[model samples]
Target: MSTTPLVLLHAFPLDSRMWDGLTEPLARRARLITPDQRGLGTATLPDTGAAPSLDDAADDVLAQLDQLGIDRAVVGGCSMGGYLTMAVLRKAPERVSGLVFIDTKAGADTDEARANRLTTAERVMREGHQGWLAENMMSVLVGPTTHAERPEVLARVRELVDAQPPAGIAWALRAMADRPDSTATLRAADVPALVIMGAEDQLTPMAEATAMVDALPNATLATVQGAGHLSPLEDPESVAKTVLDWLP
Candidate 1:
């Protein structure tokens, strides 16, 4: 980590700890400012009745930078965090120096996918985080290999999911479902960008990753083999190396 700081956003359903493996290495030449998404970290939801939107989530991240006296940083996020990184580009373009998008897409959810997320939200409100995780988490979030080879990873995932506040999850779940498509924004964003895809990612497949890379005017794509949706956990070393190589 350098004396100069950079902001790093955490993926939804997980906290900044997900970046733990890479922090020391990433911080080697740059300071990292990681925030737990609304309801996940020290940040909180707004008192206004405004329902949480993806834009709102991005606003929260930028707001954190303002709070810390940080004007801009190379923004990076995983999955939902990546989605928000795109949002940040749209909402706070001046604050972005670069982007690191991992295991996420720039398109809005399909009808079926949106419906499924809403259903998951309903269940989360009714039964809370565990029920939400039990029903929809494993199949979508964890790669098959990790579930088999690393019990500790799964356990850590469970701990992270289980630790979230019900209310926080409720708002974030809703926020994710309502996020706008950012394909256009990415295509227009002329910043240095890294599109990191998991070779075995089931959620955001290689096709989606390709679409993002193709759209971005200045971007490079790297694949982490033997990893899945949550590549940070399956191959943190690969993810770290990519980030390190990109830093100016």
Candidate 2:
């Protein structure tokens, strides 16, 4: 197996802690680096203006790589993390050895979606992430199967969401809202790619994942059945197994 490092970025409203389950299992095969993006987790986000961009977050990942003396590695992400992965590819293509995109899309947000995200950011800042997120995002974050069968997963998701700082949550929402369409970027990325999607994902469904697979020069799709947008957190073993099988 290749000793290339594996940097797995976390989704919005959560930090590097989300990847806890996969640490022991994936560590056996590769050096896993999971860092909290700027303004999230323990990492402090500098007082950048309201117009935060994923490029900045991408740069943070590259800085982390530099700190570790890793020239290149397979980078993977889920949800908002996928946007950061694409931003990394956009900014520093040579630094990426492979790509793993889980439960995300390659398209930019539509005007309506963008507006909604901005509104959510405002609401999160104003109302805080406590009641608003639990009420609004819980159902949308996970699939019906998890909602019906996995109460523990629901609790964990809630715990992660509640732990996020309001500013960080708001910043991520705005950043994601303004991210560019990554289809062309993916078309140009010549590295091996794995696109994992939840079979029951409400946000980015199978069609979106298929679209990413079609655009990439060399990419494969893995379906995580019975999961939602947060496939890794929903079923760590299945996602890890798919990743292990796909690793170069």
Count of clashes, each model: 3, 0
Give per-residue CA lDDT, model 2, range 72-175, as digits (tens). 99998999989999999999999999999999889999999999999999988887888668658787789999999989988888888888888898889999
TM-score, cand. 2: 0.97
Per-model CA lDDT versus the true structure? 0.81, 0.91
* lDDT of model number 2: 0.91
lDDT of 2 at 203: 85
Q: Which regions of candidate 1 fall more than 4 Å away from where they truly are?
A: 1-4, 131-135
Over the stretch 128-211, how does candidate 1's per-residue lDDT look in tens digits?
A: 777448436767676877877878877777777788777787787788888888989998888888889888788888999899
> What are the runs in model 2 whose C-alpha is more than 4 Å off?
none
Compute each candidate's TM-score over C-alphas: 0.94, 0.97
